[model samples]
Target: MNDALGEPQSVLVLGGSSEIALATVNALPRRRLRRIVLAARPSAARDLAVTTLTAEGISGVTAVDFDARSTESHSVFINEIFDAGDIDIVLLAFGVLGDQEAAEADPALAVEIATTNYTGAVSIGLHVARRLRMQGHGSLVVYSSVAGDRARRSNFIYGSTKAGLDAFAQGLGDALHGTGAHVLVVRPGMVRTKMSAGMPEAPMTTDANVVADIVVKSLRRGKETVYAPGPLRFVMAGLKSMPRSVFRKLPR
Candidate 1:
């Protein structure tokens, strides 16, 4: 349950090692959080996240093994977590940004991207939503992207996955309306994270902490959708309205 200030007492991060997800957790009121569950693939990165949080004096930090592609086990995995205790917030932060050129060259690679980004999200997202509805009070923060606003030739495969995920999350949010289980869709432009490293910085590129701040603020304000850096919302709107011919001419 959330505290008097409406701060979440417990957070469940599906992509525990995600820099943006971890930043959002760190930005929260640490003193009020009773539990922090980092669910991700078994790896040193997941272990490091727990160790880092523990070092920050955040108690009850635990790590659980979670593979996004393993949709068959999502039901059981989510059930086990919810059975342990109530989860105030669930961050659907797991995704893979495969090499766009490689994905275009290999149909199998494209499938991998779709599986991890779209299929896996739908698998876990529904399970999380069901649990949240049962508890009757919680928020689901989904990490969408500006690229999804309109697919670009530069990264259409990845963009298509995000576009599907964005629509699915919005519909899920609507389905959960008045159920006390809400969803916040976060669309950020190119973010400066390990995932985007080596990529050319876009016009309004920002960092993970900046996006984290927007997420926390939006959660408190009960916003349904938010664009990090604030201005990206307007920017995306303009881009979305552009003719495909003009859009294609735009820089990569």
Candidate 2:
């Protein structure tokens, strides 16, 4: 539940070790935060995240085992958490950026990327929405990407999954209309993170903190969709306007 100031007290992060998700949690008013649940496959990184948050003075920080690809476990996973107490905010931030060339050569690899990003999301996202609607008030932050706005030949395989997730999030938001629950879809360009390491920084590439700031602001203002760095909103608009013939010829 949220505090008197509407600041969230209990938060759930699906991609527990995600830099953007952690940064957003940091950006929130920590004074009101009481419980934090980080759901991810067990790893030293997950343990480190819990320890780091606790060391930083955040209370009730804990981690639970989760696998995004395990769709059958989603219902029980979500039910166990919501049954314990109300969740004020949920961050759906797990995704993968597959190697386009490799994925094209191996259909199985493409299937792995698609199932993790699209099918897993749909399975878990619906369960979360049901719990939120029952509780009557909460926010769900879905991390999409500018890559989803239009597919590029460079990473079209990964981009296609984000596009599917973005569409699903929009439809979910509409389904929750008139219910107190809210959904905020975030589209970020290249973010400088370990997942994106070794890639050349694209125009308007920002860090996790910048994306986190946007998430916090968008949540407060009740925006349905937002772009990280803010300016990329226009950049994407221009990209989308480009004709396919011209768009495909541009540098990767």
Candidate 3:
């Protein structure tokens, strides 16, 4: 393993099958990084993502099964990857957005959204963060959303979970300061992807490719927070400052 940046030339991605996650991996500088581990839920889509990565001439991209909800196995799973002592970068990109109407109608749906988006991430991410800290050098890239800035009536359940995740990432980033392990929190405005196909279009919608590109650029520059499309950072600032009485009346 080379130490061009004073760290291992390898990366481990926790939610490897995500479109944005895969895109970010593809965007990394292949000449500098030598190995990539793509961990995802045991699903056909995961296999497809692995195939796509291999086709990109990434040299050493592979997939492994990982379930975010199975908290009992997180330690063992993380150990297996870092055991080789070659991990230097990590990406946390697993998430789920259930039907908002259903989530509002059923308490169980709301619970699932919270468990999947926030609770599961907390369980696995903490473990990953600790491992990286122990190793004394790495970068953790987290995928968050601008929806987390505020809860809208249109999709508060999903938005609430994202909001929780965004907060968690920020706090984690702070805790890692001066530890040689850094967290990169990514906030994408609205991504048009398979998960969001049937949903109504939102303003400033960006593609997974755009988000990935920004992430790679941010990593190279050591930016702690990145807003995909760049302008959404200002837009979210405006959104957070608006009065709730006026915010609630505005259309999503």
For lDDT, the strongest prediction is 1
Instruction: For each candidate in turn, give its C-alpha RMSD to the true structure in angstroms.
Output: 0.8, 0.9, 1.8
TM-score: model 1 vs. ground truth: 0.98
lDDT for 223 (candidate 1): 94
lDDT of 2 by residue, 71-185 (tens): 9999999999999999999999888888889999999999999998999989989999999999999999999999999999999999999999999999999999779999999
What are the Cα lDDT values of the candidates?
0.93, 0.92, 0.85
Lowest lDDT block of 10, candidate 3 = 1-10
Model 1 ranges with Cα > 4 A deviation: none
User: Which candidate model has the greater TM-score, 2 or 3?
Assistant: 2
TM-score of each: 0.98, 0.98, 0.94
Error of 1 at 117 (Å): 0.6
**Candidate 3 deviant stretches above 4 angstroms:** 1-8
Q: Candidate 2: misplaced stretches above 4 Å?
A: none
